[model samples]
Target: MDYERQPYRRCGRSGLLLPAVSLGLWHNFGEGKPVDSQRAILHKAFELGITHFDIADRYGPPIGAAESAFGRIFPRSLRDEVVITTKGSNPMWDGPYGKGNSRKHLLATLDRSLTRLGLDYVDIFYLHREDAGTPLEEQVATLDHMVRTGRALYAGVSNFSPEHTAEAARLLRDLGTPLLVHQPPYSLLDRRIEGSLLGVLEQEGVGCVVYSPLAQGLLTDRYLGGIPAGSRAAEGRFLTPDRVTPEVLAFVRSLAELASARGQTVAQLALAWALRDPRITSVLVGASSPEQLEANVGAVDGLEFTDEELAAIDRAAKEAGVEA
Candidate 1:
């Protein structure tokens, strides 16, 4: 709960300085989770100076539930103290303009998001994904309009490839509302961003807020032994028990050993590894409990890595065939 414990990093060339580690409502804080649990995690996050909270229109089990829950737990007076980012462009309902990067869909979703979040303007509004059917120009223009109309303070894109991100960055820059951040998946078990996306973001001066930094809990001590009861691998659709094969367990054990030598957990080591890249503005992590959130935020303390440790990490990750 110490404010000075979390450090802030500049978002690209923008004036915004976001916390080194951000929280995402991608999992938990939804329909299935209790309201009291969601409130506790969110309250603890803010108390720890984790000012950025990420969410999407389609994040909840039943779409729009996450933002609605946040609206209930987050007081209007303290809204200015935190950075709220809600994404659209993902299908949330049945309609012609329910999904896509089209101007109509984007604007309609923004209005719905605002109403659900109980806010006049969000800190950042992102187009959740790339739509091959829609032109990039239409998408950027719509996001530009959101900022111009005071519906969103900044615009961003998520799950876009390096090529798409480059094009979108150019378009948004031309529109005078430069792309603020790109939310991508980058973790010890997934280093695809290092191949080219990281370079692209750096060249364009667009900050990156990486998601799944713990590889959906793969790069954690939780799976070192096996999938425990109620773990994401056992219950979540994204990560399944079958995905955690013997080979993965071996790699996880090695990584956990390395983390132990450093007096940290695998989750902390994974987060620290992701932060090693300067291009990464923040690592967006999700938590089901307040204790988990606190442990993750403590990762900032052991962020320093020796050259030998970095090399060992790369070797282990490469052996797992997870490198980009």
Candidate 2:
């Protein structure tokens, strides 16, 4: 593997350096997908210098399937070379303790995740989302315990508002387990983070690793003509068919034109745009195939954008009713 092919960036003020394009096992690494295919994608991602792999306990259709699949292919020799991250806080089992940010739930979930991944400890363990029922102190303390107990090397949070993120960072810092990263959804279609969340991460010295960089394949050419037979939208999982409205298609077409001029795919353009901000440590990408992974990672080559191109991108987004 050409490690230098993909540049590594420091995650905020932390000593950890994650690949600019990390692989996420949110969609394809489940039981439905073939094991050999999943293995191919994982191998190809590592071959392309993607050392970070992100997963969540509730990522699979039945939950815990992705981790199990990953465990089957993950080589023990390469454990030291790769960064494995998993999250909790979503419902994964029966009973009230099945999911929450409480200490009981988080600790139990981490143990189960480790068993599924066949790992003693993950590089990062995140509270998947904010749980209002649980006090912020308890939630933050749970993360601290995870790190302090050697179950996780670092702590992270996902889908957190700016206020929650700031408080968590402060609490974790006081506990001597500084927040390492914040994972949020970001893309041309969704620029919600541009207003406040990104600012908080920068001020708090928390690295920002964004997911949905391709907007669940909307930013790509796959939906240019319309949703295909077996697409994410068709399955009505996270993205619905109604999301492929005419306005969204028009927005995608405009970006596709811009991408053509730059000799990049629309997906690559979206990834590059998300990574354009220095505050962004990495952009998590999900690939169903090795070819797709290669194409997405190529975004690193054209990370720069001319002022005029940036202006045009903003104009397209604004015209498509995307708020800045």
Candidate 3:
């Protein structure tokens, strides 16, 4: 696919090079969408220079469906051409060993994920979330084991706080396995990471693959006029109608206007803003259609920002309560 045509960034100190924009299967690519439709998105993303596809056990509605569906369309020719990341630590089944960061659950889920992915090993495997009930040492050891045993080439952590991330990095370093990446939600509407997480990752030399860079589509023009029919908000799942409040919509509209001035869509602007951080390895995005994916890929075309534009974005984001 000549994916190298696009510049890839090193994941922290690791040798892994991920595209600036990665596709995420956190939404869509599941049972609700037709198999062919999902396949088209994957094809289009690959053609656009995206090499990373993020997946998790609990992504699809029925859970595990996203990985299974993606596995079905995953071409053997492209397997080595791309980087596939799957996660555990979220509940996909009932019972004591069904979820959490316990070695038992993490390893079992990795095996199941490998079977569903139709691959012996993933490019990266993540501990989907922190388990308050589990000890940090145990979780880090489990991830280290995954890499040692060749079930995953690298290890990552997601939805972890800055403090936890720092500790995890320390543990992984001692085990001779540095934390490869951390997946967190970061957008104009969500800047919690900037307060501390970003610095931690940079200091620890851990790359970041941020998800929800579009704030669940609130940063896009799609919700400018209000939630459209069949949209995630209208469906009242991850993004409910109530979440698209007057304040948030107002913020989205303002961002859209600024994007128009830059001759870019709101989605593109948000994505480019995310990549502005040198510590960010990639901005993980999810698409409902091929067109959406194409537009997102365009984000890379114009990522430059003048000081004035950066200030304006900061002002708008603060006004929108992103900093609050």
Candidate 4:
């Protein structure tokens, strides 16, 4: 439980400091997984100084399972020591009020999220995704309300385009909420954020906590040889076997070689690459086991990259059809 083993970074212009690597309870903290195993991963991650834990209303396989499981294992005594964040705006229930950025939907979902997490207030609550059907003013207002009412300390958004992000930040600022962070998918295979989202975050002084830094396990060694049984791809959950094409395998092999030369694993190399940008407040990683979490956190040890290595990484990504 050496807190000093991990490095902490300022979350944009906020007073909060997040670990370079955070744990995401998207996959492993769901039903069918043993409670003890989930607890072990959470404990191990905290011990490694990963204070931020990201969850969503629709994270579990059936939905709401991750939060329920987390509530069972996370001790109330450590609530103040960690940063707990959850998201909404995705489909979670039936009928019209099930999803979206509407005030009713957002507020109602947060209540349910709090009930499930067994927390009086979350450190940060994010709009899981932009609901174009709802006006930006309404969406931002709901987030502001969450913070002002003590339901959440900070507000954030995820999967928002650069234009949308700018507008949302403006609206939140106008309401005196001040957007805290933005969660987006970022990795070697997906560099869409580099085009403008990162710039907007930097300009707006909003923290960037990126998820899927491993490309849903694509950047890891799990698919180096082939998709192993019980893997995400094999299970057809988020990642499919078709995505492990020969070209992708080749790209990953190149990365593996580069990682080996640097005395690190491919997964670590990818995590480090994502965190290479100073705008990135933290990289959210998912783990099925405590050992896996430890390996991902190792990425922080090699966050720096040489000029040549960066060029080589771009070359490999472009060759694999990535628009980097």
Candidate 5:
């Protein structure tokens, strides 16, 4: 348990200090697994300085199983030591109103999420995305209501564009609650956030905890030769086998070379690259086991990047079709 803590970073301009590396159960922590195996990953993450764990209602195949899994392991004594964040309104019901940014949906979804997680409140709750049908005011106010009524400590938005994020931030500030964070896909293979979302976060002081920092493991050495059996892309959906082409493998190898020079892994280097930006409050990662959680958590302490090293990473990422 004496693994190095590394350091905690300020969440945007907020008073909260979050670990540089946070664990996410968006995948892998699901049904058909022993509870102790999952609990071991959770505890090991905490033991390795990963204080934040992110989840969403639609985590498992049938949905809500991830929360229930955590519900089993979260004894009251360990609750205060960590930060738990989850998102709501991603379609857990058959009705049209089951998902989206509508006030009714958001509030109801938060309640269900809390019940499943076995907690009175989450450290951070996200709206998940923009609802084209729901008015911005309705969504913002509903989340604000959750915070006001003590359902969630701080509110966040994920997969939101810059325009929507700005409008939501303005509304939250007017209501005396600034949106605390923005969760986006940011990795060696994803840089869409750098164009607009980064600007929004900089101006609004809303922090970012980026997911897919390893590009769903494409940035890892496992895919450099061929997709391993049971790998994430092999499990396929969000990351497809089509994503792993000759060019993609070549780029991963190039990045692997860079990592080798630094005595690190492509996965470690990829996560470190995201954390290099102070604006990114944390790099949210997923783990299939306690060992994966510990190794990913180990990346934080070795995250330092020299100016030249940063440029090399940019070139490799560009070759991989990732916008630098």
Candidate 6:
């Protein structure tokens, strides 16, 4: 694989430059699949210049199974060639400290996640989400400590509101440690982040690798005609038929038409639109198969969107009440 074919973008104002498209093992690289499949995807992604891979503590269907699989499959020599990012703070099961943004939970969960990943340190460790109950100070302090101790190279936060993001940045900056990135729900369907989160990231120099840029396949061509077998809408908990109303299909067709006019697929258009922003460091995508991974990475080549194309996409998305 020619890495030069996949464009790389600087992560905000940071010195780090990550591949524009990142491979996320949030869906199929977990339990209930051939372990070889997970290894294949990771190897394939790296070969395709997808230098960054995203995972989480509770990523597996049965929880921790994904990490265990990664531990078994990923080779130690290939580890330094990639940037491994995994989130903590989510509990695998019911427990007090099992879930929270408290310093104790973040530190403990990351330690467990590392053991499962079988690595001395993760490239980027995310806080998963903010805990209203736990003080932001504690969260930032613990993350800084991880960086200081070399348990984690850099720390980031996900699923945080713009206001909370600002607060966290302020807290970390005061401690002489700046937040690395913010993972937010972003896509043609979810534009809420465009309101202020994008603005905050610009002002704070915080990189953003938005997830679900396809709105869980809503923005894909998969549901344009109907939900196919093994489609996420049919097999996953996140997307449902209730989401594919007549109005949505109508919008989908129009969007697909718009994408075709540009000589790109809906998935390519959707992912490309996201990379439009300079602040966006990467688009974390979940692939159910290697074919899907190849198609998703091809999106990087189709990322040259004109202003007119963006305007048309916005109008079409607005008709369905989707944020573009």
lDDT of each: 0.89, 0.93, 0.89, 0.91, 0.86, 0.85
Candidate 5 weakest lDDT stretch, 10 residues: 1-10
Off by over 4 Å in 3: 320-322
What clash count does candidate 4 reach? 0
Which number leads on TM-score?
Answer: 2
lDDT by residue for model 3 (1-324), tens: 547545699999888899999999988877878888899999898888989999998878689899999989999888888999999998878899999999999999999999998999999999988999999999999999999999999999999999999999999999998899999988887888999999999899999999999888888888878889988899886898888888887777777888899999998998998898788899998988999898998898888888998898878767877554
Query: Over all chains combined, what TM-score does candidate 2 have?
Result: 0.98
How does candidate 1 score on lDDT?
Answer: 0.89
Candidate 6: tens digits of C-alpha lDDT, residues 251-291: 87888898888787889888998998888899999877777
Candidate 4 per-residue C-alpha lDDT over 19-133 given as tens digits, one digit per residue, 9 for 90 to 100: 9999999988888899889989988987898888999988886799999998889988888789999999999889999999999999999999999999999999999998889
Highest lDDT against the true fold, candidate: 2
The window of 10 residues in a row where model 4 has the poorest summed lDDT is 315-324
TM-score of candidate 5 to 2 decimals: 0.96
Ranking by TM-score: 2, 4, 1, 3, 5, 6
Position 139, candidate 6: lDDT: 86
Regarding lDDT, does 1 or 5 come out ahead? 1
In candidate 2, position 93 carries an lDDT of: 85
Tens-digit lDDT track for model 5 on 88-162?
A: 868889887788888888888889989988899999999887789988999989989999999999999999999
Query: Candidate 1, after superposition: displacement of residue 30 in Å?
Result: 1.1
Of 1 and 5, the candidate ahead on TM-score is 1
Error of 2 at 107 (Å): 0.2
lDDT of 1 by residue, 108-224 (tens): 888998899899999999989899999889999999999999999999999999999999999999999999999988887777888899999999999999999987888887887
- Each model's TM-score, in the order given? 0.97, 0.98, 0.97, 0.98, 0.96, 0.96
Model 1 quality (TM-score)? 0.97
RMSD over all Cα atoms, model 3: 1.3
